[model samples]
Target: MDWIVITVLFFILGLSAILIIGTLVSLPQVGDERKNLIKMKAQSYTFAVAMGYVLIQLFKNIYNGSNEGINPFTFLITISIIYLISLLFFRKKYGS
Candidate 1:
């Protein structure tokens, strides 16, 4: 029942909610070109998220050898935020 644990759970649930909502939303009928563009954007964002995870792991390995002074919860939150922001930005740029 620690506050940190609660916060992390909340963030995880919030992210899950957002993703579920996004998937459930209807896409506009667009031309093939626009659809391709959106697909490319989604792929790029997915790559960004993967890279972010790798970089975060590398950081944790280098700086937290003793596993002190580093909070993994914060890193998870940061990754989630990065993913959400990129998703929103890509959707805005290509979804319209």
Candidate 2:
């Protein structure tokens, strides 16, 4: 609930929006199969990144014995940022 966290969340969310919108606008009309493949690859990469972040946070919390707890909003924002970046990466890497 800190102001810094809130600010960061908004900033990252804005970046995500820009990336998604820019990618959508810039992308050429591709086939559905290609689109689906890009999406699948992005999602797979995002899932792995999300799991890694969560596990690291979990262990850090346990090891530190802190009651600060994990911030759900931060987690969501992190995942969204990762997913968007991954999506864009795949699109650019595989686009014709």
Candidate 3:
């Protein structure tokens, strides 16, 4: 397998895992108002970044080569799972 592929997978998995774990573990210690703020900020940023990635992928596909890379489906799935878990964890804590 390509080292680039390995590196990308590791990067995505490590960051998503850390974010999910940190959010879940810290929820109990955060106040309700702060939790709400955190949730809003996280969800918005996650969505924005994910969308930006999708747009980049779109253009990459259209451009063909020069910046060729792996399909982003895996990244999308990882992002969705992490963001969903974060939202659920926050809702459970904040009574949303």
Candidate 4:
């Protein structure tokens, strides 16, 4: 198997586990308001980034005149990784 495939799979699995754990166990020290802010901001950014990624992929495919399709899992993992990082950033920035 190619290293790229292996790396992508590893990241998808590892990030998923971290996301699930993060969701199940909310940060201990943050207040509800701050947590909400963090979630909302992260989600907003994730949405924008995901849409941009889609557009870029669409344009690339069109320009290349290829029939290739975007991998849904790859898209999910990309933006979820972004969301998770943004979540951590906001948590630290707004955290006590």
Please give, for residues 26-54, the per-residue lDDT of candidate 3 as tens digits: 66554767666667866986788778877
- Model 4, residue 2: C-alpha shift (Å): 7.4
lDDT of each: 0.63, 0.81, 0.70, 0.76
Identify the candidate with maximal lDDT.
2
The lDDT ranking, best first, is 2, 4, 3, 1
TM-score of candidate 2 relative to the true fold: 0.73
Please report the candidate that would top TM-score against the real structure.
Answer: 4
TM per prediction: 0.51, 0.73, 0.49, 0.74
* lDDT by residue for model 1 (1-96), tens: 698888867778588658735732533466767655655676588678767777777788788674444455665565556555665566677776
lDDT (tens digit, per residue) of candidate 4 on 1-96: 689897877788686768846752675444777767777887798889888988999999999999898887667677767878877777677665
**Cα error of candidate 4 at position 56, Å:** 0.5
Among all windows of ten consecutive residues in candidate 3, which has the lowest summed lDDT? 87-96
In candidate 3, which residue pairs get closer than 3 Å at backbone N, Cα or C atoms, i.e. clash?
none
Candidate 1 TM-score over all chains jointly: 0.51
* Residue pairs with backbone atoms closer than 3 Å in model 1 (clashes): none
Write one digit per residue (lDDT tens) for candidate 2, span 1-96. Answer: 689878988898788778777776676576878777888898899999888887888899889997576677777777887888888888888888
What lDDT would candidate 4 get against the real structure?
Answer: 0.76
